[model samples]
Target chain A: MPITITKSTGQKELLNIEKVKHACRRAGASAQLCEVVGQEVKQQAKDGMTTKEIYEIVQGIISKEHPPVAARLNLKDAIIKLGPLGYDFEKYIARVLAAYGYNTELPPILQGACTTHEVDVLAVKDGRAAMIECKLRHEIGIFISIKDTMSTWARFLDLVDGSAIGKCPHIEECWIVTNSRFSHDSIQYGHCKNMVMLSWNHPKERPLPAWIDDKGLYPITLLPQLEHNTEKSLIDGGFVLLHDLATADPSLVAQKSNIPEETARDCVKKAQLILQA
Target chain B: MPITITKSTGQKELLNIEKVKHACRRAGASAQLCEVVGQEVKQQAKDGMTTKEIYEIVQGIISKEHPPVAARLNLKDAIIKLGPLGYDFEKYIARVLAAYGYNTELPPILQGACTTHEVDVLAVKDGRAAMIECKLRHEIGIFISIKDTMSTWARFLDLVDGSAIGKCPHIEECWIVTNSRFSHDSIQYGHCKNMVMLSWNHPKERPLPAWIDDKGLYPITLLPQLEHNTEKSLIDGGFVLLHDLATADPSLVAQKSNIPEETARDCVKKAQLILQA
Candidate 1:
């Protein structure tokens, strides 16, 4: 009998081991490791078990050999942990955009045609510019709705109108970036208006997770055994990425985060291991 | 010495007795009664007291003679009590529109050019129709932001496009109705777009509270001494307006609400007193 599993969205379906392997592979696990994790998950998953439980099983199998891939698998949860507020996520997106050769800034109150707008991230590359709206949801199963996309478009229109009248910078593109999935209507509206929407699994060819995984841009929050306070301290100290922490001197990290040198050294070692892997 | 009182937004100002008198007069208190209440508020007022404390003093003075006016004074809070969700507030707005001779309905699902919209209330009058978005905030000091107004306009545009393509209803006006105040940028945007924004104090004249006071259209939630469960039952049974409950058959109210007939009769009598006053 096929074992049934409940998805995060409360829908039930039969557990497919191929999907398990595919997810592991997407998280940067080797094909051999993916097969091993898939077999382990198939053995353990019972009827009515949640997909979250199956995910933990896969993470455990991958973690024993490849801790970095396991960390990458937990990327969605780590990103959610970045916020009860979205300011950090906005900074993270700016950094990600910078990594892709875009010079980005969190503009201070851009004046639109009708009113002022506090834009989240503005990225410029090769004489072209984009206004990015970051929609961060701390909870799972919450979609970025059409209302959000529509408002973003409206703000873009105001900016365009302002630009025509010499009030604000001209934005060539409007982008909505979210850690969660977009609603179907949001996706349709975005496509219809030619707005660039980057979410967890949108655009099929290169979604947000794919971009992070391709660049190995894992957040420091994904480090295993990280205390909440220490993680907050690292993020506050501008060490949002594991690469940042790994490249920094341990003593400086300790001084900046106000933590013991030994703890900082251990954190650095863990970050180095993850990056090296 | 001038007494200082804190406004709801945490700004402190000198207590203006004229403002208190104005508020009382706005609530339909007799000019003589307004004078009495204003004097009592001034006598009891202290430095660093909240405007809410002063409001209670006015309500106490008025309740003894005009219970209905006192209830009307609580209209803002009463509307807030209508929601943790916005559905009841939408229904209340629809009823209010109906009372003003607009044929209204909560459309099931409206198809726009790009996507489907769950419009809050659609009101039609004199061969012109409007799509009203009801924004109900449960907390005080939360202003309806520009993003909300812009999105409503975007949705309205989609509906207009849909009508041109024969996909949905043609709306002549777009209105945003809220029990809270609108942000300054929201007001600017609404005015620029010619959108009708009816909030607690927008338009300066004939605001939401003024409209409610003009026709004595108090919600049933304003009924004094109403038990929480009893209020829920009455609201669920379609007694949203005080006038509706006042004119309802007492035995029918009791049977529908599953309350004692005497309790229902007492509720009716209280409603009658408020409506008559």
Candidate 2:
């Protein structure tokens, strides 16, 4: 008999070893390591066990053998720890988009046709501009709803009208970016409106996790040696991406973040190790 | 020098005795009483006082003499006390619309063209149908924004498309009803979209307070003798409107609410007293 495991959404499904392997592979584990993790998870699988428990089991195994892979697997939770407020997440997104070759601006208050909007991230590349609305949810299992997408579309429409009347610059595309998942209705509405929707795992071709991994653009919060105060200082000092700290002088980072030079150096070293992996 | 008072929106304006008199008159006070209250408020007024403090002063003076009018004056706070959740507010709105000669239904999950929508109130009258969205705010000084209005418009559009394709009932009008005020941008977008906006003091001529006063459809939460548990029970028992409880038999009210008959009778009498005023 197959063991039924509960998902984050509270739906029950038979535990699939292949899914466990896939998650391991997605976290940059070796094929052999993936197989080992999969077999271990299958051995420990029990009826009515939660997927969160399965994740913890896998994390415990990977952290001992391959700390870099374990850090990659902790990406989603790390993103969540970035907020109770979304300001840091927005800054992180801007840095990620900057790495993607887009000249990004943080929170420009642009006048639309009817009113003004404080856009989260304005990315312009090669004569194409995109208005990105970043929604960061701290808790797990909360999906961005259709109302959020609809309002984004409405604001985009207003900006388009403003462009025609010369009130604001022309924005060719509107995007909804979130650190969480999008609800089914939100995806449906987004596609129907032709608005680019990016979340943790939507638009399966290249989701947010894939985007982060593709550029090795992990957040500074992903550093295991990072303390809460240091993390806040680093983020407040505009070192949102791990790469930002990894490349900066330790003394400069210390000066900007109000942290000890030794602590800044340690964070940068940990960030470099993960990026190198 | 004129005393400057701060509005709920945090904008400072010179104190106007005429506005105080208007508020008292609107609360169903006699003209002579309005003048008396206005004069008292003016005498006690000081620079930098908030509108809420002014309201409290007026409420205190009125409660001492005309308790019924004082109950009416307490309408906004009473409506806020109905929430922490909006379930009772939706029911209350249905009753209010019903009193206005519209056949109303509570929260029908209608299938729109793109997705399903759990509409707050669906009201039909004179062969015209309307979709009412109730936005309740428990806190003061928070205004309903354009994002809210835009999303409401988007959902209405989807329903209209559904109606055209024979998926949902035809909705000719979309209304946003809030217990608080609408932001300037919200009002602008609402008017631009031709959406009906009913807020605390919007539309200039008739607003939510006027609507409730016109039909004497105060909520059961307005009963002073009503305890928290009894209020919950009464609301759970489907007696949202004060008139519903006032007209119900004391025995029935007690049985439904799990309260003593005497308490129920006292609540009904108090409700009746306010309604009579």
Candidate 3:
């Protein structure tokens, strides 16, 4: 008889991204890890570390137990702290494609014109490099102008044409993305190239999926920020200037320009020694 | 039928613009005017002027013709003495449009944006304004990067939208222009209900057609340098160097991690005694 295989009947445990999100709490914390990632520890990547090694790099980036010195730094620095492991995410994405048994090379990003006009991640496998344009469109589209849409779309076309990059093969696809629907021309440009487009409008939405080898092209997913507003973020970051926001609005200050409304009240409450003859 | 009306035998006597050009020659000259229209004064428009007036303004502009000095100061000193004609060219374009019979306003220019963007002119007519954006495109487009296209297209959109005009009325049209062909998307944005997209790329193209109007709608055609590229108009009005062009280009010099190019060049060219040592 063939070797029998058994399937576990117990409740399947799910690996939720939320569980790892605690990592965000340590975002600004600094000890040694943040420093390593910030510098992009180049030597580590050459060692052939796996993707798990990369997360470990970011995990090692900020020691929660330490002070928040690293918080002021950007994402690149966090990667550097991982030593060689910091470069994991990119390699992981490449590896996912590699698992499909296709040859792939993640080339160094050239400063000017190589793939998509403002491509976020460029992956080369076939003769044509499919430009992967990434966007975390913070500002909404209803707020942008049509002219902006046109110019941006034109740039996308230029990206597909490879006018700027001398010899990076070509961007067979031109993708445009947004946190929400942009004006018309943006979508039209992509249609002309028959490329994929992605836009995210709310939290709890699954963003684009990753590109797979042989089966399908890149996945489209939406990312949404939860329980996060500008004010809350600032407060959590400990960047407070005043406790009361109403006082900050000038119309509350008796039409005066210089004095803060609440502060003016406080000054009135304080005793002043003024005697007139 | 009286003496046969002999149409004056075509002696190729002279076009009115040519006659005005000759009279302007008697008046004086401007380098920047020549830079745009060409060598002869006759090249300037002549449909509405008294001929003498255009000649006088042209004379006022040419530094070498120094009115009181009788052309003795040479071109150098006159260059220094002149100032940019604050007579807005866009407004002039509008006037020329009106002079020929087009009803239009040049649009109001937003003040305080010149540090990065500039509005050369603004004219209004027919309850609408044409937001004309102009520039000479000779710069090289090197590498295309996320930020590069982002910024370039962003600027292009900004120009077309007339976002620079802080208090401009909601008019019927906006025109973004250049001395080059526009991409398809640019044409699309120009399709807005109240916008127009135009360009002048032909070898002998005269942008802003001279005969678009019959009775003329705006009428300030006497200014020769207003045609385009008038450095003397720049001089006639007065201007200070924003940044030295030669020093801005890095390929001209290889040295790095040193003092600014402008300062270095100043020292090298002006300080001769130290060089002898």
Candidate maximizing TM-score: 1
lDDT of 2 by residue, A28-132 (tens): 889999989998998887889999999999999999989988887888888987887888888888888899899999856998888888899999999899999
Instruction: Determine the TM-score of chain B of model 1.
Output: 0.95
Between prediction 1 and prediction 3, which has the larger TM-score? 1
Tens-place lDDT per residue, model 1, B195-242, is 999998888978998778888888888888787788888888888888
**Largest lDDT belongs to which candidate?**
1
Candidate 1 or 3, higher DockQ? 1
Q: Which stretches of candidate 1 lie over 4 Å from their true place?
A: A227-239, A245-268, B99-101, B227-240, B244-269
Give me candidate 2's TM-score against the actual structure. 0.84
lDDT of 2 by residue, B132-155 (tens): 999999865799988888899889
Q: Order candidates by DockQ, high to low.
A: 1, 2, 3
For model 3, how many clashes? 59
* Superposed model 2: Cα runs more than 4 Å off: A1-15, A39-53, A98-103, A124-128, A228-240, A244-264, B1-21, B32-61, B98-103, B124-128, B227-271
Q: List DockQ, one per candidate, in order.
A: 0.69, 0.60, 0.05
Better of 1 and 2 by lDDT: 1
Worst 10 residues of 3 chain B by lDDT: B1-10
Q: Per-prediction fnat values?
A: 0.69, 0.64, 0.13
